[model samples]
Target: MWMKAVLVALLAFALGYLYHTNPMLQNQTLHLITQSIPQSLFSSQHEPNSANLEETISRAWDALITAPTRQWGRIAVGVNACIDVVVSGVNLLQALALDPGYGHDHDVLHSKEDLKETFIHYMERGAAAERFFSDKEVFQRIARAAAEFPGSQVYVGGNAALMGQKLASYPELEVLLCGPVGPKLHELLDDHIVVPPQSLQETDEFHLILEYKAGERWASSQAPQANRFILSHDVSNGEMSTLETFLDSLDEFQPRLVVLSGLHMMEGMGRALWENRIKEFAVAIADVRNEAPIHLELASMTDREYMSIITKEQVLPMVNSIGLNEQELLFLSQAGGGPHSDLHSWSGIPDVGRVSDILLWILEQHGQADPDSEAHLTRIHFHTLAYHVLVTVDGHWRNQRSTVAAGARVASSQACGLQAVDVSKVELKAPLSFYSSFTEPKESLVLDPSNPVTVWQRRNVSFHLSPVLICKQPLRTVGLGDAISAEGLVYSEIVSQLHLD
Candidate 1:
């Protein structure tokens, strides 16, 4: 009888151990990426997969910059910084029920508070993340590194508000690309800014990616048409792995200027993957640039320090090989202004003007490919000039309730199409909202169409819209500038709206 009891106890113990380590059950866990994702997720295989380069780049960017939103879209970063709640909830319950001995000695799972403490420790250990962000050193380093990109332009896209507040000297614009349907929440609510277009063209200049934000449907659908000579694409999380493979397969379509924006709003996990993939792709771009010439511009709303080390340390250095400074390579947080600046609220005319100037400066910078072209890219120049007028209008109509007329008048006057969409006539199978800022704002947005709210509305805001072009146009026509205003306004409005989709 004693021998039989011992044999039974040993068999049960073995069974419990096996059950805990079961591959099938572990595969279903939330941390599967860390445990089961292939080794290739961290590897950089440079063999050109020409057929899927665009998809590959898009996926890589999404994983690195937008993973939080894509993967953990339901969680808030500040209030619910720890991922332990959801991840550990079900696991703890199961452990208690199936294996009573699991937490007996640990005692960490005895009560709710104990379980919470255990979760914090376990999550940190499992994810291998630092307890707190080391912002001071990273920011100082970023500020210093930015100085290297003399005359470089900065563009901000993402959900972090601190980033915008940091870039006091540069220009910044926040763009929301994906809806907050995932486990992460990317919120930067502003009152009124237009969205950009979805179509991208493959041209000799570079590859441009324009992402949409949550809400602002009218603004998002109206972005500028893809340039005939350039390539563009909007990325997502599901496609990240494929994007990595595609980037590795670049044989013919080696883009000289690569622009990645609208990721600050993503969750930590997504951002981590995004940074890693971007670092890998940066090397690939560098390899191509070595054979030719390439310039890469990454627009971000997160603080320089918050971004993945791959981008802050690795990717930027790779781009600098041909000598583009960190500022030109990555959009510093300051460019987007401060935490007070929301994507929904109207930005001040000065802020708008500053961003336009920066855009022109960026577009005008002569890349390694165009060594002698001192003139700014004509299209980008026109866009910059037109954006100036849009900002002025935004400032002028900041306090107005019914902004359609103001938007239309500005669009008509500036020759840019800026119009509000009739929500009654719109189709929204997936009506979602997402936001990014230089500084993380309090409750970036509230998606209650019945109340129709923006971050600006909740925060109380105002802005000025002014349109101006600093650089000399190819044709020095005076009145032509005013005449072009209306068209520019319409174009800018449309482009802005495109981002809202």
Candidate 2:
């Protein structure tokens, strides 16, 4: 009896030892597996492999069955092992959901690093797929794949904020700009722009033209001639007659590019109408089979809250009516899905840059026939969008400015291997009523700095000149030159558009 008891105790000790060392015997769940096996599996030192995974796990299971203390350790070991299997399965499922094409890339299990990279690629694929789907579709797909990726949350508001910001910032690049009410926008001064209203009747050759409402500020700024452009302000504040007049003008002008600039200024003063203007315009254009492209540039009013509601509840719906595909539509967003950058306060920089490129592309396409025609000359348009924003509310402004400068300086240092950025080129467009631009208007968008997809493409045109002098409000007048010459860091938001494969 003594010999049998000793033998049983020895067996139990051996089994317990095996279970402790073996990963297979351990639980699959992160928490339970931690309890069942030693912490070495997760350690960076020990590389994970399929065979090792199997072998270690099997030993853990064997411990529960063969050990003398099997009864005591069995429950915990079994639970841990089960948890591990589930967790691994979950990881696999999540990856597969992200990319249906996964597993075809490789057959045999390799190093942990390889597995991690593959997993990340799949996750990215899944995210891209999700962007193409609607809310309902996303919800359905996510529900099916829920067990695969743990701790994932879906935004209920959808991509409204993302899309709105994109559209605001990027206007059509190939736009036939025609306007006089606003200042000769610095961005489009060189391209086929028609200034002042009188020149509109003279030129009927161009397909599209942007026009603005007439005002005292505009009349003083009128150019020599105006191309046959669409009228932006035929309406009397809220009068329906404005649409009638606009349609009539469109028929007469027969322009291909249309733009409505500074429309939000009217909205702020309670003179603006046509809440769903984009949708209505789409319907009207479709009825007439108008091949011209239309664009509306609106600045937000004082209350951002109201702007949000309008964009989500009204503007987005209108944009959809204009027939944008999934990818193209998303490009209009401020977020990744669209055009808005998290950097600025829904203030557009990137989107406008994109639009400038697109407009240049369109014009270039048209200009190919008569390459040297003055009509194809670069025209830059600058629209000033001013909102009632408290740029420096309270004392938080000073610290925020410092933080911004510090971040820029750091970025410059890393990118150029220099302590400070040199402002080699500083270009400024003529300042209009609300804003100004300084970019060269006639350039094409360059898709890539290196290995660009299109030879004809140039980066989006910047509205502001390079090497901007940023300073605090209090120091604006007195310390402006000192800051630029002494302390300020000059940088550029170099725009680069990607070509779809």
Candidate 3:
């Protein structure tokens, strides 16, 4: 017994010494702890109850519709040349009392004919048209108006302008609408072509979103609570000229930042078109990088399957930053070969450490895969219902500046949340009640300079984890992604840049 005890003590001491001395072992230990955090610290019980969700949604809706549009109007006035792409059609929605059949959770079914049939059935069942606006027109008008204040240019292309006539709200901001416009759109826009529209066979189709509530229901005949379904037709053609037009605008305008969205285009057009578009855009952005420092950001990526392709082909090559929600992050991580891909749901909030670890792993994998890639991502932002996590490539932003930017982003997102429910005149400040139960004060993690685990050692990465203002019940979830992305970018990029200037 005495001999065994001595052997055990020596073994333990040796292992401890090795762990302390070896950076790789230390990182592995840290990885294990972080990997366990989600299951241990965050559990399903933390999810908001159905009643709370309903109430929150109701209140948010009431506040949103009644809120004044001028609040956003002010935001629109501050930005410069916000360009978006592809199909920006109206969203037709219906809140279903029925269950979401089987195998449909956050799953988008893409069938125009099937969606049309569903739309007709829902209309017959008393569903209503929630709101209608052309994404191209709305985004263009707002961005153009905002850019006018800065005396900049806003160029909107893709299928967004394919069906609509060019309308410039502000002369100072040239709203150049490019894309194939059919005879129907030609007639509607009264042939007011700012740039001659490319001839395409069809216009973009409207998106239909069906939302469902919660119940313990399953694949069985038992009905689901309420759920949402979205349907949008694909209009992502990989033609070189289409991309050339967009690149031409980039070359001419030479804007500081460019925002790319419309991931849904992949569903209809297949991965081929998606890949071509990304590669083309990435090459174009790289070629023009020497002329001006252009920042590229991608948003509204609902589909996870294409994330790996986008990350490797587009993001690593040229894109500077990428923003995604928790679920999207989970999917991307899983698809991109991260260990924690098996999470059942994102309802339970993850802590800062766990979130950071996952993001670092992703960055490490991507960086190692293509060390020769021209552009290295400067930031990876993951926004959840409860909090926001930002991982900046070393030296991107100072700690204090990042914290302030994060707080400002939180405030802006909260306002957009209220606006999502149709609340008019969003207050500049976030209400105290908006803070989530899982949220604490913003936490910062400065990577150790001497012992870094990430593959890229050129700079120390900084992570800022900020809690979000909670809305117990949210009336609408449709535009929340867009709102969050738009507001956060405006605050971090536009507002902060302006303040600095």
Candidate 4:
């Protein structure tokens, strides 16, 4: 028995050494890791029974043929910081007993106790971010390690040390987490932590994710057709001081690209408050624009009902680009009273022509309604499980060559990010099978030269679609959107810089 144990240990050490040193072996190991993850970990309890899934996949392939390519460069991302406690494979109906008529799917939880209880339940189930770091030194070490990616700097505002913890692994990346030093936040950060300019002195808040597996039968408590809910303790996030601090960080970081997220938590807080916050943010962004060009992108997992408030208060005068899923786009169309308001239902597969029309309508409405507004949306992106579609207005900051290439790169990075999360791997890179899956041709839809409905072209805007690498059995879907948005935005910035050089 002793001899056998020794032999096994020796073999394991050898294998580990080979995996570390050999690139091919490392790739094989990643593939094996991806394949070994259980479908139950992230698959939805309700599977699609309709035949439209194949149709959607086919349309996505047709869209991929038009993807353009470009050179890549280095970019920095400055984000309003918040922690995401991702709890996968949850049954929304069973866990929250949510009623479908409450509001809409993906609404924020208003009750603090209810939110706390949900967090506790998921923490017991081995969810990450359960415990705040007891020691500030340990937290700093972890954060420093995660920010190692070369030519990138991540400035996390507010007191989300846990969110910053993940970026510590990328040693070459520069990372800064700035916020007040309260007893709670102080405990999370070192006493010597340097607060960034204009940082608010307040406690941190958390974003709770009760993610259900894909293909699950669970119905949305508020919207029966919907299957997910993203609850956040973000009422404090809307305070004037917090917004000011976030703006200050923007000035200090001077990031080329900014991703505005977590605004849905401000629901029920009153329209005045929302308007004030947006005004402040817009003003700050305008100030920054005087020094350098900044690309502003808005990404949210908010409920459908909040689209109106967001469109009027935030998006109209500020955002240069918007990234959302198909459902969100449909909701935006309805909220904006566009031509596609009837598109309330999704049939698993997304229609490229319909989606293109919705985007065009959104752009046209923004142009007509806010004619006096200085900022115009240059790009509108809709990402679905099947593929990603990007519509670029002709005179936007990016040209066709750059936008198409950047979109394709973003799609590829998103596929790897999803696969990595599904398999519990932290690396952003995935195996070749992942890339191949995205570009593979399917026989469902063929492009015709004479077809009247040009799905990829409208009046002043041209659309670029790239099919995603499908994970037939996903293990987790909670952070996939954020992963895609963040990676894509960073990659786009990099490509833009390279083009400038």
Candidate 5:
């Protein structure tokens, strides 16, 4: 009787407090009441069917800047930031007992149901997408509910912020972050990452990622690939406010590498608003020194005009390097009128043949593929669940063997959330022997477990293919892409830099 009375008293107080105070964080408060989930909720690990790439992975780890460069390099990554809450996607859906309907289309989340339905709509196809939400109360209820999961976590999230943090991990690198880092975010960022004074905003919004593993099933849909579905509920990042002060300070830093991302946040904000912000981004990008290289990290975009504007008139052509996953690659190809213009959604793993065609088109048309081309694009890094490829204009990049391996290693380690990859939780899914290009299979290159990084060239462009050790139980998937791109960029030696011999 006493325990029941205590429970009643606690429930009454919680109701009264929520009725009067903040409802956005109600999930954070209620998680303490429910029993935490047990380890059994996660799936069992898998051992490799064939010999795993342990020896190759170790060599890559050992080569992790084995000789830390004596010369320091400065890098800048920015233009958006938000709080992130990550939870086991399948488990959370089960907890809700929600059979989210497929094909729900809405640019902005109208209510809690809209959020769920839209999430499943994309999840069914294993596409990476982000939808903006203005219904604060509805989003709050849903976000807080997801956070109630026992293992749910929060971090400073967004392409710019997360990539900046990843870059700070490298030695002899000065990392400057351009994104919102108010008092609350300041504590979450790495102490080494420099947050300028102008990039300040109140932390009212949080991005929720329902992360799942490969082959994880949800109702009738089975995820063909390991990926994330993001929901953005931030007015600050959606407006591209972080870049406001970034332009004024660009010359002060004079970074060797300038990274621009999160422009997709402006999508769904009415064309007038996003169009103007794109101009601002172009201005900020054009300010880089002629010698330094700039990279644009692509995101999932739904608006066709937004994507068309990217390749047709604006930002993509200004940067020399870019990083994107399969889904984003397909979307860009369609919008740019490349090979796969008919694809509106994907049902399974993206075909390697189609991916090569698009990457080649981007290089030949928009990138620096032509000998006398004034266009700046020279590098493209494409990542997938089973593999990663780094393509660059020949003679513009070096250290392919080690740089490509480093990218593959981070993809495994980051997604599994392991300090170092624990082979017990992983298996090699990448083919031991495969065709290097889309051309008629003349012959396939065999992968030796001991020496796994594959290098082949196509005319003037160079290709480095590194297979990933698939993680059976992915602990986190939100920032794995950013981490992979950062690793590849750090280990790379770009041209136009004077190196001490």
Candidate 6:
């Protein structure tokens, strides 16, 4: 101890003169010295390890199963409903029965040939993307081709539709779903879900979902992660036909929470029409804003112009909370005129430091932190393949650990397409070890098995990150994000006694 103290004193004396003359050089020297220190020296906290991973999975499930559920909480979900025609691991050329010519640049899908090219474009890069097909028959053709695959199935698809069903599963919660429910969707939805008296005469909108697993090969294209790309042609949703009907029922139903989505459906409907629809949505959201917490679940919007309008005019002032995936998160930053607005999209797991920075920016710049902020955005639940991060204002949100754990748990179960996640069929896909922030890599956020939910504070908000138990064989990738968001909201409404860690 005496020798170490002497050495420290000698080093400080040697660098003290340099520190006063050139602070940058002295700081750099200190950084080098600290960086040389081994990570094991900081193991007193918790290091992310295999044992910790297994324990976290166990604890997350325990938290979900025992979390207190909100009862009699009236929740309104609306603005889109669709039948998803799902096809997994499809061969783009064989499905279309046409050669895309591979090297051509077809940014927009117009004809059938353009559709094949766009799919190939994203597939080769292992990216998840959505393309709007203006022609209704173009989507129908893809649906028909999907039917040729043996195990292809049809499921409820849409932000409003899928989330309403998941929330209604609690039995105690009163879930009012506002959308056109054709005969097929009505049959799939639970009886607990209240379908408002709306236009039942409308034809069912269809979304073709093509799913690809990591390492899934189609010709020269291979996927980097398990994900799905959506293609939509909606006659009803594109027009905002149900907005008035939904807003009319808001007074009588008197929801505690209002969830808005599917505005992205208006992307390809031209500027004037789409802008007008977003303005109407903004009004609808504002009407319910005072009565309840409004959560916006974001989806794919290929049009940057539309993204800008929604972020600035609509989402900035009305929505209180939000749920989005990695791609949507980056795109929101890019489109919303945030700090990283230049960033368009990202593939695979995004960097934690970057994601954290964006979340902080949204909360500070436009969230409820300020007295004049209209949207009063209090909470953000961001989920991806590897992990789930929940950001919330100090006094506005509670039980964050359980809320985030529920999100991570549901992500695994729903992706596996199982009512209950099988422990044996899952693996720890998260990074064994990760830093709290890339800017401060010395502060390692090692996963502690005893404490599954990693908690931290920065400025006015609290951040919670929970690692996910990824399913080894994903039976269903579609609707997983919706399931995660729904589950997170369910637990967020009420504090749990069994789980707070």
lDDT of 5 by residue, 103-216 (tens): 575767777677677767666666677788777776787688877788998887888888988888775789989887766677888889888888876553588898766677
lDDT by residue (307-380, candidate 3, tens digit) is: 77766765554545566665556666776777466664443345444455566666666542234534556566
Q: TM-score: which is higher, 3 or 4?
A: 4
Candidate 6 segments exceeding 4 Å error: 1-52, 60-72, 100-108, 341-344, 438-443, 494-501
Best by TM-score: 6
Clashes of 5: 0
TM-score for all predictions? 0.25, 0.24, 0.51, 0.57, 0.83, 0.84
RMSD of 1: 28.1
Per-candidate clashes come to 115, 71, 25, 31, 0, 2
Error of 2 at 142 (Å): 56
- Could you tell me how far off, in angstroms, the CA of residue 398 lies in candidate 1 after the best superposition? 37
lDDT score of residue 349 within candidate 5:
48
lDDT of 6 by residue, 390-478 (tens): 99978776778888888888887777877776677676656544555544332445455446678877767788988888888888888
Alpha carbon deviation, residue 139, candidate 6 (Å): 2.9
lDDT of 1: 0.25
For residues 361-402, what per-residue lDDT tens digits would candidate 1 score against the true structure? Answer: 332332112334432122221222222212121211222211
RMSD of each: 28.1, 30.3, 14.8, 16.0, 16.5, 6.7
Model 3 misplacement above 4 A: 1-100, 105-204, 212-228, 236-242, 271-278, 291-305, 344-347, 367-374, 398-459, 493-501
Q: Put down candidate 4 lDDT per residue, 1-501, tens digits, no spaces.
A: 465456546645765786568633643554454345432221222222212222323233334334223322222333345543444323323333433222222133334334334433332322222122223443343333323323222222322342233232234334444433334444544333334644534555444344443334323222111122344434455343355555556555544444444354344355666666656656676665444344443434334445676676545445566666776677677877865577545554555556666777777766322344465566666666655666666655343333333444434334444412222222122121121111223112222211111234456666655545454444444444544454344334322333233
Model 4 stretches with alpha carbons more than 4 Å out: 1-79, 88-204, 217-228, 238-241, 294-306, 312-314, 367-374, 395-455, 493-501
TM-score of model 5 relative to the true fold? 0.83
After best superposition, candidate 5 residue 344: deviation in angstroms? 4.2
